[model samples]
Target: MATQLPVINLMGPTASGKTALACELYARGNYELISVDSALVYQDMDIGTAKPTKEEQQLYPHHLIDIITPLEVYSAAEFVTDATALIDQIHARGKTPILVGGTMLYFKALLEGLSDHLPSADIHVRADIEQQAAEQGWESVYAELQRVDPQAAIKFKPSDKQRIIRALEVYRLTGEPITQLQAKQVKNQPYSYAFQNYALLPDRAELHARIELRLQKMWKIGFLNEVEFLMEKYDLNDNLPAARSVGYRQALDFLQKSDRSLKNKAVMEEKSLFATRQLAKRQYTWLRSLQQTHQFNVYLSIEQAQEDLRNLYG
Candidate 1:
């Protein structure tokens, strides 16, 4: 019997060259690229997401990109289902699957199954929580989660309003801590794939520089215009995940300002850059945690990753 090829995971923080490496592997033949990004799933979110250009995508196709609109939601559970099916299909076709992107939550859910007991979003419950947040602020909400589920609360900061809300919601629905449920349920079924993980873990200084440069390039390419167009085209609000994306959120704030002066624009740019850096910090934390749990090839430089992968795959 022929041994099934291991699924390769090329993961990193934003602007860490995961996509470039995946494309190179695709060019080598008998491999399919599967994007694990949350933002890249939404259509018309091209520039801010740094989605592959049409030409690049044409040459090296990627599954799970532009699969939904900004108005819709794509949860980590959905990603696990979709990605699992795609992995099976690719393997049956006699090709290795290269799952690549920065969304660690999706990757985590795929590796460790989510709790089936966790309730889905209850509109009324969510509305009540949002109202409370609007009245008492997210700090109050985070405090409440800390009281109810400190294990989960420790993972998120107060500024992480979406996650805080969801954690509290899970508690309200199940009368159990989300962390406990996850730890209990995730062990019931083990994932089947033989995963070969690779993570790009650049130095902090190098990553911050790359983030700043990427944000500047996004602005130069009219990211604000893209946000404006999406706002006009869809019924978007701050609550939507797409609207809350790193660059898009800052761009929306800038567009809503009454004064579009150069000074304010610079301020918006700084805010966006800071938000992106924070995002990279969170990604690094996730990658490091995954590395400890899983067998991962960690690279300090994209050049090093390229050379190693080339020697192994090219």
Candidate 2:
């Protein structure tokens, strides 16, 4: 039997230093990076997504960034296909593939494979849900989801419009709960490598502070201008996946405001911070469910993680 190639997965919440650590590992080893972030896939979304700079890309050479425009949809199935091919190509070149990002759904799809029984996305159904959310607040939709699929409702917040919309869409299309569908057996595994999964979970308070500071830095670095440019270039709205990203959504809302006051900026910043923290909370929930994975505090245990990776691969 041939030796199975190894793949490394570095997962964490937003602003948990996964990108910096992935760059460090890329420098230290013969590793090819495949970004697992959903937001980084879109072009012209640099500042709000915290995308690696041109200099960083030249130095570390991350793959799967800037592959599509903000208007296009990139699904988990596509990620599984692309990432599997990259892993194979990297292994053929005698290099380990390092998959790094905070998108836990991508990680799950890559690792466990996706269920085949679910229905495809219905744009009309989704549009109707969005319309309902627009007329009656997202809280109303969330309450409906709770009534329809309490199991899925327990996992989502009333403010998580994207996920709430998705769950309800699934329910409306298939007349079944998404959580129940997901419980079914996976259809197939796309990759053959054994995964060495590692999660970076920093302290809660410290991570929240980092999230706020990062949002502030994004504001200083023309993040609003970037969103404005995208809005002008593409027919983007709240429904698009790119605009639905944590910081981008809040930034778009702020830009559309007729008030445009300092208070609005302050409120946008606070909302962005709160949304990021909620994202981190959801990521923590996902990370806890991952099995056979090493956990580290990226702030405090980076050196130890580096040493372990060096010893394991060397």
Candidate 3:
């Protein structure tokens, strides 16, 4: 009997060094990189998303980055479709597929296939919701979502307009609670290959320091300028998914304010840092939910992880 092809899933919270480890693995050959990040899919979103540089990409290409415009939506269902195709293509070429990112939902959707019965996004409905959000504030929409799907609403912040909009849109279109529909979804495992899943679990203090230092570096190295450029070029607002990204959202908020006096750089930095920490918290929660995955302290056990990978696939 032939062995099934191996698929590597490298997951971690933001700043957990997943990308560096993946790149090292890619450098060793026999691997093709596929990004699972939600933010990296947007074109010209390099600095805020911590996207691999153009030179880095040229050296070791990563599929699915910069595949969509900032204004467009990229759902987990879309990620599954694209990643499934990429995995097959990579396997056909006799190379192992290395899927790496912090986007837990995308990872889950790709590994455990989405429901065929779940309704696709309706643009008209989304636009209407967006309009409602614009007119009455996202708080109103979130209130409505709480009334309709309290379980789902509780999962997201009232300020999380993208998710709030999605949940509301789902309810509006199908007349069913989004949480209930999700619960009814039959688990469909799509991959023929066995996955070797690994998550980088860094010390919380170390991770927080890294996050703060990275955000400071981003601020120093034209992160705000990048957001400013996007805002000017794309007419991006808070409602857009791209603009709502952690660092970018805070930068956008800072940039939009007419009163420079009201713009406190420290406040923006603190908000971005807090938001990123919150994101890491959610990621940790997701990581805890994943079954049968190896966990490593990337800061301390990366060499051990590398050796394990070699033994698994060498």
TM-score of each: 0.93, 0.89, 0.88
Q: What is the per-residue lDDT of model 3 for residues 83-158, given as tens digits with 9 covering 90 to 100?
A: 9899999999999999999999998887677776567777678879989878998878888998999899889888
On a 0 to 100 scale, what is the lDDT of residue 66 in model 3? 96
Q: Which regions of candidate 1 deviate over 4 angstroms?
A: 1-4, 121-127, 154-157
Single out the weakest 10-residue window by summed lDDT for candidate 3. Answer: 292-301
> In terms of TM-score, which candidate is stronger, 1 or 2?
1
- Full-model lDDT for every candidate: 0.87, 0.84, 0.84
Off by over 4 Å in 3: 121-143, 150-163, 261-263, 292-303, 310-314
TM-score result, candidate 2: 0.89
- Report the Cα RMSD per candidate: 2.1, 2.7, 2.9
lDDT, residue 27, model 1: 97
Worst 10-residue stretch by lDDT in candidate 1? 184-193
lDDT per residue for candidate 1 within 1-314, as digits (tens), equals 45545899999999888899899989986899999999999999999999999999999999999999998878888898899999999998989999999999888877777878777766567768888988998778888999999988888888887788888989999899988877777642355678889998888898899888888898888888898889899866566778888888887877886487899899999999998999999999898887777788999999999999998888
Global local distance difference test of model 2: 0.84
Against the true structure, candidate 1 reaches a TM-score of 0.93
lDDT of 2 by residue, 75-119 (tens): 887888899989999999999999999999899888888877667
Candidate that would win on lDDT: 1
